[model samples]
Target: MTHSSDLLPPPGDESAGALRVQNLDLNLLKTFNAVYAEKHVGRAALRLGITQPSVSHALGRLRLLFHDALFVRTGGGVEPTPRAQRLAASIDRSLAILQAVLDEGAQFSPATSRRTFRLYMSDFAESAFLPTLLRELDGRAPGVVIETLHIEENQFNVAIESGRIDFAMGNFPHAFSHFHHCELLQERYVLMMPRRVAERYALDDHFVLDSTVPPALQFIAVSSHPQSTALLEQHGLASRVRVAVPNFMVVPAILYRCDYALILPRTVARAFAPLGEMAAFEIANASTWPVNAYWHRRFDADPGHRWLRALLIELFRIGTREPHESWLAIPPNLRPSALNP
Candidate 1:
């Protein structure tokens, strides 16, 4: 009887020119990655620019090469076998390396590259980064499209591991060992309220915390992560939650409709201050949120990935410097106001 390892080729096993010399085809590995990503052979076929029959043939080869069903059909969809699940991460990394090599000489001119970047970010990050990033992309990569997936902090690792998201940028205190990280920006918390409230109470005046208080401030809590929720508790303000929400994009619109105070990053509050409907004041707490760019280690060396990340870093750098309202726990006369404000 032959052992399983005997039938399998070792890592990086390949002949110079013959596909038959090795039982596995590198092209089939690409097909496998697509099918695993889509979970449907038809969609995988379209992604690989091949016919459905060809995809099926590739899947058949993959199954025989590994001597496992690889994908088992159930409930009108297919699920990866245990072996296939184990092979997934390495296969994705390998394919990326292979593709990078095949196109090593190509230029990564963002202006001409029509690619869609799927980014995972919390609504808070989106509110802070989107406006400036969009403007820059319009002038740089006009045809590059962006799609965002709202990520709860805990779901970040799984999202990046599955190759479903290219990057996750958010304010979370996470140390992901499997991916690369860069600090895009750091912001302190601010208390934003309507103009009337700012006038009624001084920044130093201590306010009582209560659940029954009328909705004096529209507190926009980002519902996706415990970290955002934890900020208030860590600062002894958990009982002050009057409004619970999930997206920062909707905060401005909601604040425009009512008088509400929310705890947000100074940068974020500043970005929305120009809307002409609200004001922002700095909270005394020294808590900070760090915006990070996270990508899988597999793509760390890929030229295209590097180019896109560099552009994003530049965009974030320029956007965070915009002048706006300053919320500080001090008298207005002592604060340095924005030059334009």
Candidate 2:
């Protein structure tokens, strides 16, 4: 089989003449960087808000330009070839320098820039912040588009480190250290049930006891968290999950007309409360989860990235305090600070 190096056009070949003689399309470098950063064409496409086919097309062009496969699929998604790996450091440096030059020129304006900013978030984030954020962006930054991307915890750090993503906000696991993080806020987990159901039965058994509270009352769960199960067992309630939904949105959507109770974060509950008439109660055994914003150091000095980060911080501020500080202020219903505070 012919390897990538063998595919390089000859020094004087007509195909190589144009790229050598004239202006090279620097956009190709962005494509190359994305591929290198994500190590997967599919993910790079999502990051760039393009199609997998487009990423593949870009890779084909990059392969011809560099005469290297650049990346080859492996047991762990796609891995860069030796030539591509060797080019990474230099390519990153070049990209950073280019971004620096662009930043120096007053070309990017968040208010007028028609750029799409991509974010990685959890389902809870999607439910809590995305709608308001989109409306705000539309009314203010008419040209901006917000793209929410899905993240896999196992591969997330590598993707973040490579500059495949501009920023990500969520309850990221603690082991990821390759990127810089800003504490966005902390939110408490709560119990959600239709107000009617909550009124009919007092929460006397503790948050966890509802599991075996008779199958007459069902339980809806955010399937990913281990705490959901533990919370049930803690109250000596055998939580027999009648329905397990993957996202917070789905939990409330399903519970609206039914008697099922859900365990979720308060931020999520408030967002969906009006739609479902769902009421939230502090989960006695639940602890708050920290939410953070993260970015690769590569974009730390880029003006556009700086602007975007600042905008997010501004919007999340509450009560004249930053989101991080305001998390301590309990909502009116749960105003008494906990001993944990």
Where does candidate 2 stray beyond 4 Å?
Answer: 1-107, 202-216, 317-341
Which stretches of model 1 miss by more than 4 angstroms?
1-105, 151-154, 202-240, 318-341
Can you write out model 2's per-residue Cα lDDT over 270-333, one digit (the tens) per residue?
Answer: 6666555555665565777777788888887777788888877766634322232123222345
Candidate RMSDs in Å, in order, are: 17.7, 18.9
- Residue 190 in candidate 2, Cα distance off native in Å: 0.6
* TM-score, one value per model: 0.56, 0.60
The residue pairs in collision within model 2 are 211-239
Candidate 1 lDDT (Cα, 0 to 1)? 0.67
Q: Give a tens-digit lDDT track for model 1, residues 1-341.
A: 54323444555566223445356667888888998998987888899899999987788767656766788666766778898999999999987897787776454778887878889876667766777677778888898888898666578788888777888887555646868878777666656766556555543223323332233333556665455567666655567676787656677777777666777666666666665445555444446656788889887776667888897776564334443333212234433332122
| TM-score result, candidate 1 | 0.56
